[model samples]
Target chain A: AQRVTQPEKLLSVFKGAPVELKCNYSYSGSPELFWYVQYSRQRLQLLLRHISRESIKGFTADLNKGETSFHLKKPFAQEEDSAMYYCALAFTGGGNKLTFGTGTQLKVEL
Target chain B: SAVISQKPSRDICQRGTSLTIQCQVDSQVTMMFWYRQQPGQSLTLIATANQGSEATYESGFVIDKFPISRPNLTFSTLTVSNMSPEDSSIYLCSVEDQTGGDEQFFGPGTRLTVL
Candidate 1:
């Protein structure tokens, strides 16, 4: 079974401070991890994927295979960064099914 | 990325009634998915909807409770049957665009409140 765990349900950070949202996964094969963000009044959207090896909106996540973690981090948090963040694992199969973690609500306080 | 849209952005429904949510993609997609997010919770995948076959439901979600239809590649519908207050949730539809690397783009979810 594939599982993703997000330990924190709510994480508060001050604006201009660094922030990190933890995520860990359990999978048998090479894991494909993703970070999806849902801002207030907006639909859920993909922030980044491990396979891309790119950053979006000043956020970057390094897929640590040894740690089995893909923690989303930003050097300086902004008020606009406040949103619900979800970490997901895409299984290696035909259907392309995804197993998601319990989301972390990021509150970037001004 | 794909442009995905869902109907009835929000609805208040009475118990025992059913609501059918429709998902439309701007471009044709081979794979579509349905998910549920309860109040103060994360996303839970309900089922996988393909273009030309019966939907594949995940554990704890049955076809009788959540009947899905994917008659074509660009469109699909999910009907929540026999609703209850516990069923109040935001249901989301997502698609995998082959061109858009492994990321599943999501729709503006339908918020359903069962009373």
Candidate 2:
């Protein structure tokens, strides 16, 4: 079974500070990791994917195969960056059903 | 990436009643999924909706409580029957578009609250 684990429930940081949201996964097959963000009163949207290797809104996540981790990070946090972040894994050939981790609520204060 | 839409963005219903949520996609897709996200929690897979067949439900979920319908490639519906307070959650529909590296596209979830 493919599983995703996000260790933090809430992370508070100040503006211009660095932020890191930890995410670990357990999957036998090659994992396809992704990060999704949900802003207040807005629909959930894709933030970044391991395959894309591109950063969105100054946020980036590197998939460490050896560590089985895909942690989301940002160098400088902004107040508008406050939102719920979810780490999801898409298991190939498993009906493409995505397994999502318990989200981390990030609060970026000014 | 596929564009998805869901109806009844938010609703407050009494216990013992049922609610059917609708999901529509801009393009045709083969695999449509239904998920339940409790308040401040992760998303749980409820069932997989495929055209021309019955829905495949995940563990701890039954067809009787969450009946699903896939009328076509671009649309699906999930009905929560005999609802209870515990059923208060956000219901979301997603698509695993094979063309888009199977990246899942999510719909604007339906927020259901049971009294």
Candidate 3:
């Protein structure tokens, strides 16, 4: 079974501070990790994928195979960056099916 | 990326009733997925709807409880049958990007609140 764990429920940080949302996964096969974001009154959208290795909105996540972790990080937290972040894993042959983490509510304070 | 839309953005229904949510995509997509998001929780996939095949349901979800229809490549519907208070949640539909990769585009979602 593939599972994703996001340890934080809510993370509050002041503007310009660094932010890190922790995510860990348990999967026997090679994992395809991604980060999705949902802003207030907006639909959920893909933020970044491990395979792409590209940053979106200054957010980046590195997949660590040894540690089985894909943590999202940003150098400076902006007030507009406040939203719900979800870490998802897709199975190698599971046809793009995703198993998502509990999600982290990031509140960037002004 | 695909443009997706779900009908009945939000609705409040009584228990024991059924609500069918429709999802339409701008372009034909090979894979469409239905997911449920409970209050303050992450999205959990309910089933995968293919164009001409029986929908494959995830564990803990049954066909009798949540029936899905995929009559074509660009449209699908999910019906929440015999609804209860626990069935109140946001139902979402997403389509895999046709261009390639594992990226998916999501609809606004149908918010169902069972009374």
- Stretches of model 1 off by over 4 angstroms after superposition: none
TM-score of each: 0.96, 0.93, 0.97
Runs off by more than 4 Å, candidate 3: A92-94
lDDT of 1 by residue, B4-114 (tens): 999989999999999999999999999899999999877899999977899988889999999999999999999999999999999999999888665688999999999
Query: Chain A: TM-score in each candidate?
Result: 0.97, 0.96, 0.97
The 10-residue segment with the lowest total lDDT in model 2 chain B: B96-105
Better of 2 and 3 by lDDT: 3
Question: How far off is residue A77 in model 3, in Å?
Answer: 1.2
Q: Write the per-residue lDDT of candidate 3 for residues B1-115, one digit (tens) a residue.
A: 7999999899999999999999999998988999999998889999999788889999999999999999999999999999999999999999998586747999999999999
Task: Answer with 1 or 2, whichever has the higher DockQ.
Answer: 1
Candidate 2 lDDT at B104 equals 82
Output the number of the DockQ-best candidate: 3
Which stretches in model 2 have alpha-carbon errors above 4 Å?
none
DockQ of 3: 0.82
lDDT of each: 0.93, 0.93, 0.94
A26-73: candidate 3 lDDT, tens digit per residue: 999888999999999999999999998998999999999999999999
